[model samples]
Target: MKEKFNEAAFKERLEAQTSFPTLYPFKFIVPKKSLAELKALFPNRQLVFKDSSKGNYTSVSFQLMVPNSERILEVYRKAATVEGLIAL
Candidate 1:
């Protein structure tokens, strides 16, 4: 998946050594309707939402501190097992 960055924020974060940055692209078998579940699963992670289609689907860009990769992977793995979630 392609990404668009918040350049200034990314640069600042990178310089600060606060978080490891990565582009995690996910897929959803069904269009996203409720993000509350995802939010609950990742309370401290940064999540960026985007539209994949005007009226049908969506794509989410999730950014998290590098340490959280395992945690994030846990969430993604679980979600992927669910009816609608996928990793792109």
Candidate 2:
């Protein structure tokens, strides 16, 4: 079964693990077709995309200077909206 991500717990963890204004790395694996929608989440940042060996999937990752846990969670919220996105 797929594990459910608890948004509240994750927000608390982010608060404990990182300080405000830190560089945060977001990672996700998604269908190649969803690339555009994913990139739209971080329009000002450069997203690194690595194509899967079979070329059907893409691994997306990026680092952004986030101001606080709230901002980090906001990114997660937007990311969750993408279809077939696997957060890592």
Candidate 3:
């Protein structure tokens, strides 16, 4: 079953563990076909990609300098729109 994301708890944890304007890392696993759509979310940002063993999925990772936890949450929210995307 898919787990629900607790935004409030995540926001609290992020605010406590991270300093503002920090370089944050984001990782996501998506179908190979959805790579372009994922990349479009972070234009110009350097992204590292790795293929799953079967080559059907790709792991995309990138870092961004965000001003606050809200910004981090925003990125996740946008990324969630990509079909078959799993954020890590």
Task: Give the number of the best model, judged by lDDT.
Answer: 3
List the lowest-lDDT window of 10 residues for candidate 2. Answer: 38-47
**Candidate 1 ranges with C-alpha deviation above 4 Å:** 1-30, 67-72
TM-score (C-alpha) between model 3 and the true structure: 0.94
* Residues 20-58 of candidate 2: C-alpha lDDT, one tens digit per residue: 899999999999898889988779888898999999999
Q: Note the residue pairs that clash in candidate 2.
A: none
The TM-score of predicted model 2 comes to: 0.90
Go through the candidates in order and give the clash count of each.
0, 0, 0
| Cα-based TM-score, every candidate | 0.46, 0.90, 0.94
Residue pairs in candidate 1 whose N, alpha carbon or C atoms collide under 3 angstroms:
none
Q: What is the C-alpha RMSD of each candidate to the true structure, in Å?
A: 9.2, 1.2, 0.9
Instruction: Give Cα distance to truth, residue 44, candidate 3, Å.
Output: 1.4
Report the backbone clash tally of model 2.
0
Q: In terms of TM-score, which candidate is stronger, 1 or 3? A: 3
lDDT of 1 at 25: 45
lDDT of 2: 0.89
Q: Clashing pairs in model 3?
A: none
* TM-score winner between candidates 2 and 3: 3
